[model samples]
Target chain A: MKRLSRLALAAALMLALAVPVSAQVSDGVVKIGVLNDMSGVYSDLCGPGSVEAVKMAVEDFGGKVLGKPIEVVSADHQNKADIGANVANKWIDVDKVDVIVDLPNTAVCLAVQKICQDKNRINLISTGASVILTNKNCSPTGFHWTYDNYALGKGTGTAMVKEGGDTWFFLTADYAFGHDLEKSTAEAVTKSGGTVKGSVRHPFPCNDFSSFLLQAQASKAKVIGLANAGGDTINAVKQAAEFGIVQAGQRLAGLLVFISDIHSLGLKTAQGLVVTTGFYWDQNDETRAWSKKWSARMNGRMPTMAQAGCYSATMHYLKAVQAAGSDEAKAVAKKMREIPVNDFFAKNGKVREDGRMVHDMLLAQVKKPEDSKYAWDYYKILRVIPGDEAYKPISETECPYLLEKK
Target chain B: MFELIGIPPQALFGQMLLGLINGAFYAVLSLGLALIFGLLNVINFTHGAQYMLGAYVAWLLLNFLGINYWLALVLAPVVVGAFGILLERLMLRKLYHLDHLYGLLLTFGLALIIEGVFRNLYGISGQSYPVPPVLTGGYNLGFMFLPLYRGWVVFVSLVVCLGTWLVIEKTKLGSYLRAGTENPTLVQAFGINVPRMITLTYGFGVGLAALAGVLAAPIYQVKPTMGADMIIVVFAVVVIGGMGSIMGSVVTGFMLGLLEGLTKVFYPEASNTVIFVVMAVVLLIKPAGLFGKAS
Candidate 1:
């Protein structure tokens, strides 16, 4: 009886140690949670479209990662930081979500980033624009995928300054992201030899930009840099046209513009507006073919950069998981940095130590009404900014990882 | 020619004119609220939603029917006001005899449902409405270039406000309407159809909101939340102006717009909250409001 009991105990211990090799995923199912502005100003840019993109990636990756079934779940943050954090907490702790993606609003993105880091979950940011995500609050498991404020500001500012829009007045939104965008754009403007005339601050989600636009017109700057996004940018641009700010010879630079915005503003009002973008659907065969497929599912609405980023990021992360042979957050994150990202959205993209995925961006001018030949044809690509030029240099990164290394 | 605190005179005047233009919107929106509250006493929380519907109707007319802006300006109000009539007849009428909270709750829920339906139909980035050719150019005021559309907005607002004020303050029908709302049974005994007057009054007020929406379509993105954003500020203006006073809402609306505009220039950060500050101050000093008659 003593010999038989000892033999059973030894067999049970061996089985426990051997189980990990077969089941690398902790929860047996790899869950991905997409949290974004599902019903706010940015809904069109990164809301349900983002969810579909991630699901598409999962399906394209065979609906499984590391021999475990992959599941996609999404929720509306409603543009509130607290709600985003609550959802992120529940997703990570309760649902055992392996990764979170597509956080758009700056406050919400930053909040979720902190929560994900604490919970040891991967945070893949495809939409939020603040440079602080990579600089001040970089996490080992967090990846800033699509674009940042610095990328947008520098790309558009340098292009505009070269077009003889050397003097600029800014219509800035009053918020963390807005101020960051203004600062980044201002730095870029100065770096590129453009002198900022002055600036006016408007409330976020503002409907009437008449007061602010009047100030901009009075400044007599050669160019007006609208350092705002979504609805605020749309209204400012629309009102600027009404005030004849464009016709009077002053150019307007939409610092952060989405194809969705151009669609809303139409060609007549949005024409000739200089913009910087990470992805344009109709860029080339790969992008056009991919976007055509995606748009077919989206009721023919082309994928915005953030939505496309969601697809690309999800695909890359899945590939990394497949390579690492695990869904563990740290292992997958490490594997993600090791493998180079080559997708339709990002070409030869490399994830730096600061967690910024350096990728090529496009500088384009909105096409004239007559220049637009077909539906959803908006941009006339001015130039391609190589990945290094679009994103911030590693030398300038204040990410704690590099600082601790120093 | 003197500047107010570091802002140049040109900037100040430009801001004032711009503020007045915004004030035109506030005045029109609050005026509608005042008309409804004065007679119907329904506290139409859906005023903002109706205003949004007005813009959508105008957009639909232009897009689907190939209608021009001028005809839409006339037709949208009628259509949206007709919608308002449906709300009153079907739902709002039952709650009219209840507490103010009941009516407020019903209208608030209706507003959300309306906004949600629109949000579902249109994905919320919003649609654009172009300025007509007639309203395209601007007069080069030395201090600022005033858009022809803006000038037209102010002009239309004044005409509408004045027309409503005249009908309510000077007409025999207006007196009958007022008396009917004051004492419905007495007014009924006097051989007047008081119920029909109240119903038409509610429609007229809602029509006014839709009219403002049409005027706003070109300047702002015609989105579902446009009315929602403006309604809170307009409510503050109505409260400050005296809830049921037509002239009170009109004057306070314009005044607050100018104040907000000035705030944008001097202290831009507080512009959105400055109106609420004024409202708070007014509430502290005189709970009845600046132009409110003691009930």
Candidate 2:
């Protein structure tokens, strides 16, 4: 019996030794999770297109890092904070995922950020617009990519106010996104010596806006600022046209809009409406080239700002992991912050210590019906706000991560 | 004291007009929901999706069939109602003998399937429908501009709601429906086809929802999610009105819409949640709701 036990022990030891060290050393494969609002308002921004963007980045990086193949997986968080946290925890603890990317909704992004901090994993937030991700709730492992509410509001509001369409009235959505946008745009309007006469907060997904439009008309503000996004924005704009609010000498400023929203509104309704963002398909030669490739791959849906950010952030994460020679979350995260992320979307963008990725923002105006020489011709680039001017001052953010010593 | 917080006359009257417009939609949709639930005993969670389907049908008719709004206004509801009948015959009829909750579950599943397919195909972005040439412009009231289309929706929905009420309350078919609801087996013995009545009742209810959708398409974007958001508020409206009387649902839907408009003027922060708060208060005071029958 003693001889048999010794032989069994030897056999087990030899079997363990025969297994490749790469599997045990975390060098065989790196796994990343992409979680976002897959079927809600932000779906177009980061749904299937986002997953494809991440996959493309992996392919661009040769699909391997540190002698290991890289793998990508994704889930739809459905815009719920609890659901997002659950997915993040499962990705980290069960699947042993090293990174999570492209969380869209602000509440969900904040909740998932806490989970990443606890698990010591990296989270690349590309679709969310709240500044708080890089503010009070910032974590060393969380990186805020793409545009946030402050950048969009300031970029669009200041430019429009400077153009002498100063008196403003807001038709805002009733949510965190709308609140933040209204606050930021209000500040910009006030800062530029423009008066905010009044504002109306509409219920989200409200199908009719006659009452709100009536209030806007009564306010008689020169610029009717729309501090809403997605379907709400389109509905508000369309109703405004029906009410003849635009022809009544009031301008509509779409503080945050995507190409998809413009498509829904059509050129006639959306024409001359000014908005601001960090990405547009027709802005530059590089963007157009990348968009053409992506459109072909995505069956002709143009890449939104969130999708572009996903591509840039995923490429950067893989490159960092390759440079670090390990899938250890802390080491790879530190390398990511140190490296300047370069892409077709944003040139020489740097991830700040507070986890905010600083990039140049753009202002674009909706093209008129006659301006459209082809399909998908939505916006014409108005101006590019430099990186320093686009974002809030670093001192303004209350992130603890930025306060900590390097 | 009322005037201090009171809406301006122009604003009040304008908002009330706006309220009526919103109430028209609420009245039509809730009426449909109440009717379907009354006989079919299914919540028809896909009611909103069906409404969206109505709008998309109108859009497709215009785009593909070269049918104008007038034609679409007639055809869209038929198309959507037929689809509703198909849904009932295929899936909903199977759950009648089970607990009422099963009916709710089945319809909810159908809702998910319909919404999922639409989201996958068209995405969340809205599609615009042109205002018919006749209702394109607005009439300038001294206080506010009133779009002709808004006025039309309110008028048409009122006529439709009353017409439906008349048919259900006065007609022989409606009496048989009422009898069948009271005693299905007895009604069958009385030489009435109870099951077919239930099926047609569901179809009628779905047709009402589709008509509302057709009316709404020009005013709102033809989006996949248009129905999902509206349905929740309509549920709140149903709870507040108690869904006991056809006229009660219609009246309450308009009243609450005006109240919401007033809230937008006075306390903008609570505008989104005001209806829900009213619902909670109503539940606390009268569990059966203002017009609802007590279980």
Candidate 3:
């Protein structure tokens, strides 16, 4: 009886040891969760299009790394922060998602950022526009990819001011993202010798921009800076055209313009509008090729900068995992900073200690209806703002990561 | 010369004009709601989706059938109204003997289904419908540049509201509708076909919303959710104007729109919430609404 008990104890010990070993190996399957605005106003900017972009990146990377398969899962947060947090929590605790990407709204992104930090997972923000994500809210495992408000303001505001749009009036969306965009664009406008006549704040997701447009027209400013994004920007611009704000010689400076907005507005109403972006699908041969593959999967709708950023960020994240030979969030994040992103979307893009991905931003104008040769040929590149010059300086940020590094 | 109450006269007047345009939408929509509620005693929640459908139908007509804006202005309502008639016959007609909430719940579910279908097909970014060539430009009204399309919207909406009022108040058909609202069974006892009148009334009310939708297509983009938010405010206007009266709904819609416009000029932040605020105040003072008969 004693000998039988000893054997049973040994079997139990072996099983206990084997459980962890099997768990470790099974965890090798990397899961990437994309939480974004799937059906809301920002859906067109980054929705199913973004999910398709991420899948294309995975397939392009041969669908496997470290002898383990990579999996992509997505959920619509419905543009609610609490819902987004719940989704992020489920992804982290239940699904063991290694990375989260393509968060669009600033409020949702911030909530997900906190959840990611608590779970110690990697988060790559591809579509969110808040600069605070890299400043006070920066996380060690969080990387702010694509464009931010500072970059947009520097690229579009400075250029517009230089092109004789000095006097400014703003029609801002009343929310965190809109407030941040307006604040940054106004700073840039003031820095470039432009005078801010007056500004009005309108509710987010609002349909009627007529009153706000009238208030802007009353300012009689040379430039009406649209410090909103996605649907709000589109609505404001269309209403401005209806009010003949453009014909009266008042320019509309879109602070955070996306390719999707231009597409929806069409070239006739959206012509002569100067905006900044990190990626234009028709920028070069490589981009065109990648965008073609992306468009094929996206129902022939060309990928927006946010969608392209998803592809670029996913590809880079995978490369970092391969380089580190591990899926641990900290190691993968450290490796992400060590490597330079040379993807088709961004060349020589580097993730900094403050979690800002520095990449070249392009200033482009909507092509006239007469200049069209193809369906998606919408932009005429006016200038290329260097990556280093476009973003905010590291010394100016209050990120704890930078302070700790010093 | 350009200033008014610390704001430019141009800005104030421009905002007022915008308010009037918005008021036109509210007036037409509430007028429909009141018309239906009078006889059916069921608040048609699907009214907004029907409005959105009107816009989409107009767009489809223009894009697929090469229908001009003028023709679509008449045809889209007819199409949407026919759908309304079908809905009344197949579904809404059965719930007349049940609780009023059943009809409300039924229409609410229908609204969700309609909105979801459109959202699934088109997504929510909204498609642009160009202003007709005749209404493309605007007149520099000295204080404000009045876009011809906007002016046309206000004018057409006023005519529609007045025409509806006249038809319901001054004609023989109007007497029948008013009588049907008071006692459907009594009217049916006289061989008036009250059920058919109820269905036609629902269709006409729905037709009014669709007409507003066609008018709004160029002003606001053709979006599935365009009428979703507008409908809520129109409901508030109905509540404030007393849902019992057609003329009351029309007047309250335009007046509230102008109030909201003035709010934007004076305090931009309160423009959105002002309508609800006024509704609360009106409800507290007169529970039955301004034009509603006391029970």
TM-scores, each model vs. reference: 0.97, 0.91, 0.96
Off by over 4 Å in 3: A1-26, B2-4
What lDDT does model 2 reach?
0.85
* Ranking of all candidate structures by their DockQ, best first: 1, 3, 2
Per-prediction DockQ scores? 0.87, 0.63, 0.75
Binned by DockQ into CAPRI classes (incorrect, acceptable, medium, high), candidate 2 is medium
True contacts kept of each: 0.90, 0.85, 0.72
Q: For candidate 1, lDDT tens digit of each residue in B1-295? A: 5767888998888999989999999999999999999988889999999999999999999999999999999999999899888888888889877899999999999999999999989989899988888888889889898999999999999999999899888999988877876888999999998777878888988999999999999999999999899999999999999889899999998999999999989888899999999999999998888999878
> Which model is ahead, 1 or 2, in terms of lDDT?
1
What would the per-residue lDDT of candidate 2 be over residues A1-406, giving only the tens digit for each residue?
A: 9999999999999888766443432636789899988888888767889999899889989988877788999999989999998898888888988889999888999999999998888999998889888988999889988898889889988998899989999998888889899999999889988989988888775666777878888887899999888877888889888889889889999998988788878999989999887888877799999888889998887888889889989899888887776677788888888899788988889888788889898899999999899878888888989887899888787887666753
Task: Give the poorly placed runs of model 2, Cα more than 4 Å off.
Answer: A1-27, A404-406, B1-6, B178-192, B242-244, B277-295
**B-chain TM-score for every candidate:** 0.98, 0.95, 0.97
Evaluate residue A334 in candidate 3 and report its C-alpha lDDT on the 0 to 100 scale: 92
Q: What is the lDDT of candidate 1?
A: 0.91
lDDT of 3 by residue, A313-371 (tens): 99999999899877778888999999999988988999999899999999999999999
Please provide, for model 1 over A1-406, each residue's C-alpha lDDT reduced to its tens digit, 9 standing for 90 to 100.
Answer: 9999999999998899878777788889999999999988889999999999999999999998767899999999998999999999999888888899999988998899999888888899999999999998998899999999999999999888888989989989988888899899999999999899999888887988888887887788998999999999999888888888889888999999999999999999999999999999999999998899889899989999999999999999899888888887888889999999998998999999889999999999999999999999999999999999999898988898879998
Query: DockQ of candidate 3?
Result: 0.75
B44-71 per-residue lDDT for model 2 (tens digits): 7888888888898999899888899999
